[model samples]
Target: MIGTWVSILPPLIAIVMVLATKRVLLSLGSGILTAALLVASFAPVETVKHLWSALTVSFWADGELNTYNIFIMVFVLFLGIITAFVSLSGGSRAFADWAVRHIKTRRGAKLLTVFLGLLIFVDDYFNSLAVGQVSRPITDKHRISRAKLAYFIDSTSAPICVVSPISSWGAFLIGQLALILGTTTAVNYSPLSAFLMMAPMNFYVIATLAMVFFFAWTNIDFFTMKKHEEIAQKTGQLFDPEKEIPGQLKEDFPEHNYGRVLDLVAPILTLVAVTLGMMVWTGYRATQSLNIWAIFENTDVPLSLVTGGLIGTLLAAILYIAQMGRNETASYRLVGKALSTGVKAMMPAILILLLAWSLTYLIDILETGPFLSTVVEKSNIPVNFLPVIMFILAGLMAFSTGTSWGSFGILLPIAGTIMINAAPELLLPALSAVLAGAVFGDHCSPISDTTILSSTGAGSNHIDHVATQLPYALIAAAIASFGYIILGLTGSVWVGLIGVILSIVVLFTIWTVKSRRQIELTT
Candidate 1:
């Protein structure tokens, strides 16, 4: 029990440090170091020696240099490159221009922002930037806070990936499930099936989207936004100087003109069209080498993401050059500089990723999994409460690891085995529990790439974004946990119905309370 306390201290201490100091990277690094110290502190000298050996062994044993990891990295890099070109060539700007032309009202602008976020489900990385860049001008135009825009982008990024087929997330889920299933028989987890099955269970995600539409339509948030609105109304200034971008800056980069906006739009659309075609091509070509049963044998995640991103960037660049007459076209030197900038923007995300991976290793060294298993088995909770328990367990593990995929990798196998032995009928609910919890933890984690992107997208402080997002995520998770409990009692569809109803009620209640309070304060 004492050893278990030692195992858990690192992440807890780290969270406190982050909340207090607001330094994201420092907090994560301290957490990793603490986990290492815990392993060295509690275990015997011989055990410490063995642990050192195990660290080296595990590092070498890790298939990171394998084709799979390499492909995923390449995809991430390529996407960065593509996004750079989109930004440089004004593809993102062009899209923004077109959006502004069509979406005239503030309400229309916010709704379109959410819609565009859904549309960019091919990759979370793409979604963060594309949604942020294209919508920032319009959001600013309407006096919407960057914080709110970030919330929309952050919430939508993982939520969409977790739910949408034909994404890196979809591929990763298939690969992870296959890893656990062990037969390579194209187990029932196709991208589509996984999407449909998990979508209902994804209560936080579903609720968040519904909340976004409601808030966007109603202009309601309890704390910060409400206060800002009152201040604006009282002062006769619609735009808060603290929140708005300066007029001089806006003058330098004026809102969308048609030609400039088209310059951005054509290339991005081309990239998307080509990426889809490439995915189809890859799937088709893969069959030539492997049987249908082995559809995912050696399938590459990083490679797919990078390849799509790179191709999109290239097409975007070419279109930009064509749009710029020869004299004004991107020179080789300028193109190189732009590519460098693109890659540089990804540096923080890449560093966070490596650190996040190391953090997962730290949690393993801390023995989180066994500790969780012990606590759950000993708690004497009701049998029907198991799924809810699993959800909490999965969330803790994910928050500590800072990687939903890693959490899923470990817990899905355990949950799968448990379902087989303990309650076969509860299999889907258990699996759904794992997925929902993992995404929820990832969504809130300071070290998460999605979290990092949200800050970058909004140009808000990372801590500011984290602070604003937590309340919403936790509220949704509470509803989701109850939903899983209901599923445990009934079946999947019934649970979904209950979840949908509960989520709506919850969202509406929160908004109503917040809105009424604002009205009361104003009056």
Candidate 2:
């Protein structure tokens, strides 16, 4: 059961239950318990121990503190506090008022988010949270749904990081590629060169990014997303007030009349600057090298996050304090309230994150990833369909395990080995398909950390984010699958690229026409 088909059941059950009940903690708990039972061979005492270990390991592991998990959790709490402080300082209201006066339209607001998402590609976690902080006020001002904002954040963060050579994702993947290609004497390209070459071949990233811009510029949405957008536009409600919004402040702070846009911009800028600087400094310290790529590859990302978050949080608090004498609304008494509200706002996200991590830990113990990769390894599929098959398998593996990095670790070597032996010419395309599929699946998986953070950043209900984003992800995935098929069959990246572009054009054209007709009918 540990490394066989039975290992797949827990994730499937979790996914199905979450979708059916929309109770994230309960679903994740069920999955965790199921995996623990299986790992403990259905012995009650052993299952309890496994569960305890899983929960404890999130903070303490291997005779030491799990700094990575602790730092990330601390970052989340810091972000929440920053949001509360920003609002208490009247930065949120002031920024939204400024944006409404300048941006003037929903399209401008949405496109602002798109551009911000693209610009912040250093790390997906940072991108997700930062973009939401900047864009949420603007988008909410224009009545864009929280789900839609989450979609924008989710689409831009991972896809951009995966492609950008300077990003944390790029550094990690390059390291993985070095190991994968090191085994082969036939491949002549360096890991960095291979990564750059494979970037254009990642059709899912291309499709997803294109869809993001299309939706941003045209304001077209479908399925659950369309419903969310309509509700927002008609009612001026960003999300259902009744639902659990992970990062939404439970207590509303009074806005200061003298609040300025600088109040909002300064703290966010401080966060981004500090985080990027720390990433380089930490990486340089670790490697003792001046090389930019080497620095990124060895950077302590979680440490950087907490460092930046602490600075940002302090700056936000200072800003509120600075307003004490100038603004009648500002008071020392409200400082404690803001801190408490901020922590309360982030509690839901923290709990969900912990549960998701626990379940992922149990899933790893189950060897679920290897089981899925094993199935792909032993398949006797034709060479022409290998790219598509790898794409699907990688997507499934990532979707089940809720981690694209995990999928990359397990699948890249397998795909490389398979293609190196079967057809060396198709190696890059096959590997690109795996990368694309992992992002696609991660983009859709409810339990994915990036996905959860996107929801948190946008202040949306987690299930709403997952539900609204799924249809769009599936559409992009379908286009990517077609592109992979063409690449595999023709053995040409250019032809495959054309196929992806054409598919997007065709789908967008049809969707546009149908949307116009529906609008005409409504009018």
Candidate 3:
């Protein structure tokens, strides 16, 4: 029972199924089943039966799709409903139309699209749909590919949220930190400070945004993209501009008949304000109750995000109905219809989540993390170079797993423990490395939820987007790796900070030069 063959089979099966069929659910499900079968093969019949029973109970009842899993699904549905209502009331469209009227140039359109992504970091799901839906029309107007729009949306999703301390991601990170800090102490190591510290070190995110800005300002793209832009310019149809909306978008779909932009902008702003205010209030309470904080900190984030999103959506729905001049009671029907449409739009995400969770559970049951960690330790890597090795390992694990949170959950605690033990000074940098690597892998993995949502949002071929994005991610990763080495040796934040800045400047310059040449040729 070496089980060596078992180790490799599941992922191989998953990859083949995904590449061959392009069916995400099938691939993920196949991966889970394969792992289970492998585990069973190694155990005696009686042992196998017991293992199966335990694994099933753990996976279904306490695994990824258990309590928190259900919450995220419900939240996504709620978000969908809110978005649907906003669109139905011409709020979303109104905002888009207004942006179009104000920002006329193609360059400005791309810049504004990126800006929208950064602004909507409250939640990745919201960032995905809101930015995608709002910017699609503008990107179409500028002849930007849906692929590019998806790139912007995907880059902004977790990257922005992870760095923003007040976002849903921020709340979650803070809660996790609180637990690790033993919750009762009023420690200075706030999740907010951690985010701020790492923001400068988040080279991938910073570089990607710089690329977007450079391209928008100069119109430069690498080899094939430039050609695609040229062809789009000549033919006027490189990317399909088809607008798919829940029945709600009909009135504002074409944009010409949409209401004033403020109708949309006001509600969205209100949603942001209310959500942030609630989070602040919740955070304050968590800080005040030492006992309750210790017990509730672990659960606060998902709870808060769901509640905040629901409240924001409720407010949006009210405003939508108010715009229709209907009595509050009469407006229930509109809200109901919008809710139905919204939940329907999120059906795909809901299904994917279940399958993804199942796959994650299977991996955990197989003890993938410990197995992988053992392999890395055996590689005889130097203690000093371990941070760099961990960075690469984190990326590989995340890409294979297709879940950054899973990657972080498995690797962070281990890496943190090891770093603190090895070079106490390197604790923060090592933590940042784990975070960066996880994000990098998630950024490019085709099976990643964020990646899938990005493709769905941009309407790009999933594989193509993954393939195109890999280069950018790898480049940033290479630079980040070098930064990790410098930090490990010098033990100074400035080394990594300077490295990140240099990487962004160099990448942005390349983007600028290529874009300017393309624009001149197009003109």
Candidate 4:
């Protein structure tokens, strides 16, 4: 089954089961077991061994600790603790009251979230959690649904990071592009220049970002998102109370009378500042150089995340303790309870993330990504259609593997080689297509870590987030596909960009006309 069509079954099964059952863990478990059985040739004992190995690889791999996964998990826990302390110190309530006063409408709240999401472009992981923590109170005050908040966070995090040269995603992709360009004599542009050139050529990012702004400003929603929004507006319920919400505190703590907005703003600022500083420090240590791009390229992102999370947790804890002197409801015992509650709040997200990682690991071992890449490499498509074909294939690969980075690793070089041999002029556009498609698939994939984090950050039910965001993602993807086709046919980035903008404008115009008709009927 490895490196064959059968290798695709596990992810397909997992995705179908998740949508059908809304039981994330069970669905992931089924996929893991199925993949193990396939790898073991249906032998029960070997399957058990494969399953154990797959599960533990996230903790330990290649005879050493897997610092990347472990540190990211630690960061998630620390973030949860920070949130608990902030709430315990009454920062959440204080911030909500302040934001409600200043940000008078739901549109203001949504646009605020969009701004935060775009502002925090250093890393997608950091962007998702930090933006959610800062914006959730304002959004909640204005009756914005958790699913909608997750959508905003998800849309901005990866799309912004993928284009920003200073971001973790950009650093990684640039490194890959350097290697890819090194192998070809046809391309003369430096890696950094090529990355900058590809930025505008990433049609999906433009389409998705445009839709995000439009949705935030107009509050136009459809499918499951519309239902979630309507429920929130009608009853003040941000999510279904019955569903399991990750990163939501189960126990309510007493609010201090003297709490201020500074209680919330200070810790978030510390987290962001410390994390970015550590990234530069770590990068400088590795490269003994002063170039900003080189620093980002060499930075230890997971280490920076953990360090910043620790400092943020400490600051939040100190803020809560300071409330003891001024507020009658503040108590020493609640400090211990806060830590426990914080850990408990993040358990659901952690479990789902671990399962998703395990499944992704097994999928890699099955060579699903390589198999998909092989299909694209072997296709004898016309040069004019190569960009769109690569976009679609890259999307399918990332969707099946639940990891855009994996698709990038596997497909980028291939895209470079194909375009260089077929038409060197289309190389950047083709490469940009891969990046856009990978993000598109990541947005739609239920098992994607970024998707899971966005749900956790927004305190939304995981399945609800996935379900609500799919329609919006598909709409953007369709527009991007049209744009890629235009780019392939005309060999002009500007024309493709115009095509994407026009597509969005036409769609929104039709939607607005239909909306007015519906309003007239209702009235």
Name the runs in model 3 displaced over 4 angstroms.
Answer: 1-5, 19-21, 42-60, 63-65, 120-126, 165-199, 223-258, 281-299, 308-340, 455-464, 489-492, 514-523
Reference-based TM-score of each model: 0.78, 0.99, 0.78, 0.99
Q: After the best TM-score superposition of candidate 3, give how far the Cα of residue 107 lies from its true spot, in angstroms.
A: 2.5
Q: How well is each residue in 247-293 modelled by candidate 3, as lDDT tens digits?
A: 12222222224345555555556655665565556656766644432
Candidate 1: what lDDT?
Answer: 0.64
Better of 1 and 4 by lDDT: 4
lDDT of 4 by residue, 91-201 (tens): 999999999999999999999999999999999999999999999999999999999999999999999999999988998999999998998899899999999999998
- Top lDDT: which candidate number? 2
Candidate ranking (lDDT, best to worst): 2, 4, 3, 1
Number of colliding residue pairs in each model? 9, 0, 3, 0
Name the regions of candidate 1 deviating beyond 4 angstroms. Answer: 1-3, 39-94, 122-126, 171-198, 224-259, 287-299, 323-337, 457-460, 489-496, 506-510, 513-517, 520-523
For each candidate, the alpha-carbon lDDT, in order, equals: 0.64, 0.94, 0.64, 0.93
Candidate 1 lDDT over residue span 360-402, tens digit each: 5667767776676567666767666778878888888777656
The residue-by-residue lDDT of candidate 2 on 1-523, one tens digit each, is 8999999999999999999999999999999999999999999999999999999888999999999999999999999999999899988889999999999999999999999999999999999999999999999999999999999999999999998989899999999999989999878989999999999999999999999999999968888999999999999988999899999998978855877788788999999999999999999999999999999999999999999999999999998899988899888889999899999999999999999999999999999999999987887889989999988998998899999999999999999999999898888889989999999999889889999999999999999999999999999999999999998888899999999999999999999999899889999
Task: Tell me how far candidate 4 lies from the true structure as C-alpha RMSD in angstroms.
Answer: 0.9
